[model samples]
Target: MAFNNARIDAVPTLCASCEGRKKGICSALDCEQLVELAKASRKSTAESGATLLGETEGIDRYANILSGVVKLTKTLPDGRQQIVGLQFALDFLGRPYCSESPLNAEAATEVVLCSFTREAFERMMQESPALERRLYRQALDELDEARDWMVTLGRKTATEKIASLLLLFARHAEPPEKTGRHFARFELPLSRADMADFLGLTIETVSRQLTRLRNEKIITIENNRLVIVSDLRRLKARAGNS
Candidate 1:
């Protein structure tokens, strides 16, 4: 998919996420300290599908997204992949102190990242208790999200998976106005292939399920971009407790 580089470059100024700011994870720091840390950050961009780091690869740096999306995927020797997590704007990647990564991180869409050398970042964290605390919180939050995904993948049916995923988008999604209970729209962050991998289903199965949802009047898709779901409660019912 094509992305506008000019638009992406314009995004950081508009970013509301902490990582986009000078203090970043050190949001609790004094102005002087934040100013020092911000000076060390460098910006870089990656195209969709670019492999940032593969599983088992060494990580010399850690980064925070400035724009777009990234996916962290784990694969088996038999050629199956399961998307473990997604890194959106303001999200950090490449844990410090880890020599090798367990998952491969790739650009799910064109992306920009603000990078810092791992050693330098670790040093800063060591000196900054507030930063360390924030990182710990971030780790715990990710763990919770992982457990949630596991529940969906292991117990939810195809219809349920779609519902749960859409509900997730709704939680983070920003619409111009609260649409009536019947309908809402948002762009999908990942392609059908990535969605299939994340949900532990075949691409064909994903396509069929999407079609079935539309047939049931649950959702509508247009231009490979927007998804409009009518009756979110029905979607939730389809998701059930799983």
Candidate 2:
């Protein structure tokens, strides 16, 4: 079938279920524009550890994360790997005009995405100035975040790094409510090994820091995955947050 002729009628329903629709790139689109865009898109789910894109591969599609977390990693020819970034719900997952992926994006937890073919997405961007503006804003936001993380990786101690990571997850998982309370309870999306990769530390060091936090009564672990923070202020102090 011709790519343009493959339009489906399910796009509106799909957009209705997407949490990212209101906050992501699609937010710039009106109802009519959204339905039109959706006609050229589809919904997909990836299991934990599934690769959404590989380094140096052609960019076939762009995706907006609907749920769960994705880890972006870069590797050297010598087999060294580093976790470069993490994408959460409502985050866009691909470079718009770029032809190839610069890094690998893998699901750190099971994830659902709204997938749009690159050609269709680009065409929409050209037609909708609002969409283009929205994408540009997102690009700038991502650049700012990357700069902040570079500082964290370069200057923070291992303990401080772990604490910072935990605080990031807490903020992402449950944003503070209007009640002005700061406690958070959520599962750690990345495994210990993944956390080590993200934090530029060894797995043993990550484990040790987690233990120290628990010992200090800063955080409580209900299981291997779940974490509860009773005093966010203390956690932030441990993270070296001024």
Could you say which candidate leads in TM-score? 2
Model 2 spans with C-alpha error above 4 angstroms = 1-11, 175-180
Query: What's model 2's lDDT at 110?
Result: 95
lDDT of each: 0.76, 0.88
Q: Distance (Å) between predicted and true CA of 96, model 2?
A: 0.9
lDDT of 1 by residue, 1-242 (tens): 24433233222322334455653454555554444455566778899999998899998888877777789988899988778888776677886788998789999889898787787788788888888888888788889988988889888888888778777765555454767854567788888887887788888988888888888887888997788877777777777753
Can you list the residue pairs that collide in candidate 2? none
Task: Name the lDDT value of residue 133 in candidate 1.
Answer: 89
Provide backbone clash counts, one per model.
Answer: 0, 0
Candidate 2 lDDT over 74-190, as tens digits, reads 989997878999999899999878999999999999999989889888988999999999989998988998997888899999999999999889878855464347788889999
Cα misplacement distance, residue 202 of candidate 1 (Å):
1.8
TM-score list, all predictions: 0.81, 0.90
Candidate 1 TM-score to native: 0.81
What TM-score would you give candidate 2 relative to the actual structure?
Answer: 0.90
